[model samples]
Target: MSCRVGSTSSAPEGLWHWLGSIPHWIYPTALRRDGALWRQVVLWISGICLMVAVTGFWIGVLRLRWRRRYVGGAFTPYRGWMAWHHIAGLVGGMFVLTWMFSGWLSLNPGEYFAVRGPTRDMAV
Candidate 1:
């Protein structure tokens, strides 16, 4: 079976194919110039994406009206790109955060979250 590592099984064909790649690919950093610069670019972009996703999602949640609808009887009190941003933020933010975080973790800048090797007495 094909590993559904980042599958969009819920969406119908021709709709979710492109969006389905986000979680798996996250960013096209790997396809960039293969050198030290690429690593830094990935780290920076991942960190930024994670932060933006978190903050945007939080704001969207705050502005989301489940019980009392908005002016147009809509759940969101936004229109145009704002509306798309709000909706997309709520829907795709989580996935973006997940993939971005995983990408960031792989980079592990400053070695802050880096794990030390097994102890001498530790079993192989």
Candidate 2:
């Protein structure tokens, strides 16, 4: 029997790794029923996530005034919840953007990490 990825949509259980050949109907090895295109799906999803992180960082920076201060000479006009948002966005947003960027880079969409197969000269 061959093992398959779990749909996770209906299955209450979390996830499972494929250690050996097992029937897919019996047990799935993934969280979704993405079939063989799971990697591609994840790549596209990662791109969206990266864009969100970038937008968040951009907003965080724009919300703050550098040269011109607020009424009380404050760099930010936000107060209470908004103030917390500004602080977290300025600080946490950086970390989130960095993490998403690194993950996107790791995907190697430009074939930068491509490997060449054995040449004809190589021994059989």
Candidate 3:
């Protein structure tokens, strides 16, 4: 008799199994094999992205405040270009912040959330 935790077949059976299979489909075997290296890379990238989002938020705030104080209306430095820049920065900054935060959390999930069972090993 054989015992299986999530599924008896090769295909994932439940939400947990589907979630576990994500890394295998997304990341390359080489990256998965060297978990330490992959983690370091993610940390560095997430850090950089966080820094960028912070700086962008600061710039946007400064620009908006300056325009409101001096110009007394919606006055962008570059007019049309600056308008688009502000819109993109405001919307895209949220996305960058969230994505980087999630990436950082993924490095050591046990710290933030409970982890069950033994860690999965890379097939390669």
Candidate with maximal lDDT: 1
lDDT tens digits by residue: candidate 1, 29-56: 4555475666677677778777877887
TM-score of predicted structure 2: 0.62
Candidate 3 lDDT over residue span 9-89, tens digit each: 554344455456544333556776897777776667667767877887778766764535444365455467778988688
- Relative to the true structure, candidate 3 reaches a TM of 0.52
| TM-scores for the candidates | 0.49, 0.62, 0.52
Model 2: residues with Cα > 4 Å off, grouped in runs: 1-36, 117-124
Best by TM-score: 2
Model 2 lDDT tens row, 10-99: 332322333332233223346346543555655677888788778878877887888888878778888879888788788987887788
- Candidates' C-alpha lDDT: 0.72, 0.67, 0.64
Write out the backbone clash pairs for model 3.
Answer: none
Model 3, residue 105: distance off in Å is 1.7
- lDDT (Cα, 0-100) at 109 in candidate 2: 56
Residue 38, model 3: lDDT of: 71
Q: Which of candidates 1 and 2 is the stronger one according to TM-score? A: 2
